[model samples]
Target: MEHRDVGILHPGAMGARVAAQAVTTGAAVWWLPQGRSAASRERARAYGLRSAAGIRELAATCEVVLSVCPPAAALDVAGQVAAAGFRGVYVDANAVSPERMAEITGVFEGGAVTVVDGGITGPPPREPGRTRLYLSGDDTAVARVWALFDGTALTPVALAGPVGRASALKLSFAAYNKISYAVAAHACALADGHGVLDDLLELAQLMLPGTPLAELEHLAAAGPRAWRWGPEMSEIAQACRGVGAPSGFAEAAAATFGRWEAHKDDPAVTGQRLIADLVQGSSSST
Candidate 1:
């Protein structure tokens, strides 16, 4: 069930990551930018991706199309797929809600292209790691879609039923994971302020890996680097609101991340550096 070609719309971090995976899995990968972001352009250059002149070109050329654009761009890309008369499975793996997934599904209704509602969990496969990609469109091409990720970090799960379940699961998972990161960030910062970050770390370790202290350390230590997570936390906060859930921690930490973003581009700084400051700064100056 190998795809002859795979096209990635939006060569952003996640998109590029997935594209790298697809190509590594032996799919002849092509890509088009969502827009012109310098980082994305650099990634495309690094990966040697064949650029599609436009959506129509990509839609006409590829057999497997994956929409990894931003959550806001999800519907637009789906519409483009429909308009271009795409002739393959379009996996909508944006971080959008269930309602949005259904809307995208409608965009491809009765079209030659089949739409699979997919939510990608975890970062792009940098190594041979596995991140479950929950799929729920009930499309017959799901098995083929699964094959696309067979040797990659993605394990595609075709969840039985409607198209929104995978998106729902994604939102739910993001909500919890974002909250967990928020809690860890807050706790570690507070403990650092109280001059007990080391003690707190020790206490966190006693939980025998169940606690996310290690992850917290990574996030905190990667301070400027963690700024990339800012928008994601904000999106997670939005997801909770859309479903009547409390997103306090995510919201608060997102604000904290906002402060970090302000200095993310500093010559001598990174999210990790700021996190280290928060974790080890002097009490009086902290």
Candidate 2:
């Protein structure tokens, strides 16, 4: 296999891991450090990703660019890449609505860039078979992206259909996975309010096997990512509306997650505080 030059547009937690996988495959992965936080820089350096001076440099150098950012920023990031004269295979692996994904693809239409829709499901790729990176687009583009991670820690699956298929699949799964966590947090809050918190956990242990309710603290653990998950839930809501499905559940879950936005990346957000935040309908608690 020929060595490929790949660019990672801002290596956050997930992006860093994905780039590291590319590095393991002998791909020279590039990242932009300008304006990125200290933690992002640390991750990029630790993962052995070469730093590009700017988006233009990254665009000018790499044969492929993979985007793994917050859902709301997906379009903006794509637009930046398009503006930077990127003319390669661009993989957007953000959790976003298919409609939003289509808009992102449109940003590069009539250009040299081949836009590959990528939707990541499961945790960050620490090992093989633990995560799936679903790709959909031109068959060649999908295959190209698939080749980047084949036999690596990230399992890339090629999907048949247009660019939006992977996004649809991702949102469809997140709509249930994320919203169910939010709903479980709400239930915990409700029980706490009624002084039955202990009782609910006892009952959940007996009846809610293999569910979020059974592992109550895991829901609180979600707080660190709620800032991004909030927008992801809204994207899922948009997807539901686009399909003529009821969007209420997703909308409500978005609001539920919004209350934890301030806790982004804060490790100290405990289950007790998470339930209290829900009960108060705010994240202002210290």
Q: Which residue pairs in candidate 2 have backbone atoms (N, alpha carbon, C) closer than 3 angstroms, thus clashing? A: none
lDDT (Cα, tens digit) per residue for candidate 1, span 1-286: 4447888887777788777777766787788765677888889878767888888898899988988876767788788778987888888888777767778888888888777888888767676655778887656777777877776776777898877788888877876765565567667677777788778777877763655565454554334434555655666676678778887867776665555554553444432345554455321112
lDDT of 2 at 275: 81
Error of 1 at 12 (Å): 2.5
| RMSD value for candidate 2 | 1.0
TM-score of 2: 0.97
Give me the displacement of residue 175 in model 1, in angstroms.
2.3
Residue 14 C-alpha lDDT in model 1: 72
lDDT of 2 by residue, 228-256 (tens): 99999889889989989999998998888
TM-score of each: 0.77, 0.97
| Decoy 1 TM-score against native | 0.77
Off by over 4 Å in 2: none
